[model samples]
Target: MIRKNYNSLLITHILDGNFTYVKNGKHTTAHKGDTVILDCYNPHEYYTENGFESIWIHVSGSNSYELFEEIEKSNGTLIKCKDIHYVEKLLFRIYDSIKGDTPPSELRISVDIYKLFAELLNFQTTKSLGENNYEDTVQQIKEYISDHLSENLTVNELAMAAHMSASHFSRIFKQQTGFSPYDYVLIFRLNRAKFLLKNTDLSVSTVAYKTGFNSESNFIYFFTENVGISPGKFRKLKF
Candidate 1:
């Protein structure tokens, strides 16, 4: 396959042989049962010395590029899938949703996309850790950020906590976590709010304050923007 100036995110689950190609001047190959994620924007082509079969889905959305860029930064275009059968099921579900009797609902489709990406992110390479062992360093950074989500945690503060310069901290952080410091804080807050909403009877306003949002409206706005539902509605999902 060859395409230039393509604009969708492609996730391919290989079935036979290997996918060999040159992407951005880097030649790589994906063996059978491995998943390959390629950003379509760059010029590339793929073929195998032997025949190959695969299931692929092209995705385009608001955050596709940002997520793909993170994956690329971590390791080129391919990542391992822990359970190839699970991936096959997911791909089949996506296919059935698109072609089955009832058209797939927007919520259902979005959920499928989320699950697929989550699987991909789980298996990406931690290349930013570089030559030395930084497991403890990264763990410290996570703990500090998790412990102080209410405070305005910036890259500088996080770097200080990890005893590294901001530039180096950010590079490693992004590789290890798939999120910038700010994004990680935002996600942490949102997830905390989700936990509160699902497990407690606190009003949305109180939850907002507890999660570091300045106002209930702002919290609701951010929650709805990322979660595709209101806090009230999401709470009902769990209950």
Candidate 2:
């Protein structure tokens, strides 16, 4: 266990077991394959639990904090790695660069580190937003749909909200989320329908209308096509 403050951000990769952070009467756990961030301004207690091991890297320079600050403002948290293989490859690359012992200035290691951080931010944002690009727009769309799934949705209107051309939005949305805009809207409606069916006593026709389906037949057709069962059958199974 170690702690220090520098002009740059530090990243620690937990290779085995777990680590804990204690501050302000709260404990946060980072298990194996997890990564943690050490900010330059925050002082906190950290320790390994259950025989933990980790690799750490310190990055310091004039612009080091600047990059981290930008990432923090955009994404908030720095500890994210669900896959161990990805973390291992990143750590190996950083170690190899440090061990190469080439001219430090010639290596431009800080720039590489910033790029890695950017990639991590993008990955986390994409995973959370359900799309790789236009994350802010995607998040907005999700919120709007969640709040107003009963209202009719059009690709033109959604693209306008995203501030992009309809065709362009459609293409990029499918590329990022693996679903066309229409299909995603349908999926949202279907999911909400299931929730209402299971939890509420609304008639099938009412549920279909509230979920933006034009008719009970259309709702049943799509529900059966996508869910492999009619909404009535689904409700019965739940009951």
**Candidate 2 residue-wise lDDT, 1-239, digit = tens:** 33445455677777888766643323345667667665745556664424588887877666766666766666543355546577677666777777876744435565567656766555564474444357557656766766677788999988888889999999877864568999888876876687678767999999999899889999999889988888899888822
C-alpha RMSD (angstroms) for model 2: 12.9
TM-score for each prediction? 0.51, 0.48
User: Any runs in candidate 2 off by more than 4 Å, and if so which?
Assistant: 1-133
Off by over 4 Å in 1: 124-239
What are the clashing pairs of model 2? none
Write candidate 1's Cα lDDT for 1-239 as tens digits.
56878778888888777756657534355778888888787788765544678888898886877777777665446766667788888888997888889968778877887787777776644434443246557756766765676677788989998889999988888886667877877877886677678667999999898778888899999999998999999988832
The number of clashing residue pairs in model 2 is 0
Q: lDDT at 16 for candidate 1?
A: 77
Query: What lDDT would candidate 1 get against the real structure?
Result: 0.76
